[model samples]
Target: MDFAGTDAAEKATYSTLTALMYRACEPIDDDTSVLARVVGCSVRTFKKSLEQLIRKKLILQLENGNLWSVQIEEELKNCNENLNRLSERAIKAANTKRNKQKDNSSREHDEVMTTSSRGHDNIMMSSSRQHINNNIYNKKLKLSF
Candidate 1:
């Protein structure tokens, strides 16, 4: 909005405010000189802009020597909460999909095992029949001799 300063001063104030918002509740170096350098402005200009912002109630200097924007802080908190909710939902969906895949794999394994067991039983029965037929043919040969 109306920062009430020269163009450079307004730009400095806007830059400083933006930097604080990027920090997201973390404190920044409150030294005016350091802040001026960060915002690419003279220390005097930065201080004047800061005062105007304070008088306008657009920014607050906390007791901990950090600057805060009430509007930005609230918005950041809301964004963080929404991100957490979406993350939880995504994790839950992934787990459900993994479980379904595991169940399908287990079912497939069981079907294979059952088929193998039936094949083994059939092989044993076939072998037993062959042995009985051979014995009968040998007895018949002895009787004919």
Candidate 2:
């Protein structure tokens, strides 16, 4: 909001800060020429804006000539950690669902096997009764003859 007023220098400084933050977790090189091009400003103007941001302690210049924003880095780290936790939870849920399905499948298979065994026993008993009946009928016919 401070950069929203009619101050062009503040706008440029805001743009520089935004560009640095846009690099996500990585630090940008302290190259004013390249940064000026990115911010659509002259190198002198970019340096002035950069100096303003540094003075405000909004941007950090590391010893390796890299510019960084600690807030952005911390935000990106938190986001990554959240994504990792969510991914792990998703994987665990999938495995639990798969195991439940497997258990159900095994139970269904056991039930089917039990029912089939019972059906087989019934068929064998019916066949044995039919054979006995045929033998009794044949014996009766022979005695009448």
Candidate 1 at 128: error in angstroms?
A: 3.1
- Alpha-carbon lDDT, every model: 0.78, 0.79
* Per-residue alpha-carbon lDDT of candidate 2 for residues 32-136, written as tens digits (9 for 90 to 100): 788788788888888887777776766788899888877677788899999999999999999999999999999999999999999999999999999999998
In candidate 2, which residue pairs clash?
none
Write one digit per residue (lDDT tens) for candidate 1, span 1-145. Answer: 5645447776667667766667746545568887778787888988888887776777778898878777777777898999999999999999999999999999999999999999999999999999999887878434553
Alpha-carbon runs more than 4 Å astray in model 1: 1-6, 135-145
Q: Give TM-scores for every candidate, taking all chains together and pairing residue i with residue i.
A: 0.79, 0.72
Which model scores highest in TM-score?
A: 1
Instruction: Give the range of the ten consecutive residues with the poorest summed lDDT in model 2.
Output: 1-10
Measured with C-alpha atoms, the lDDT of residue 14 in candidate 2 is 65
Q: Pull out the clashing pairs in model 1.
A: none
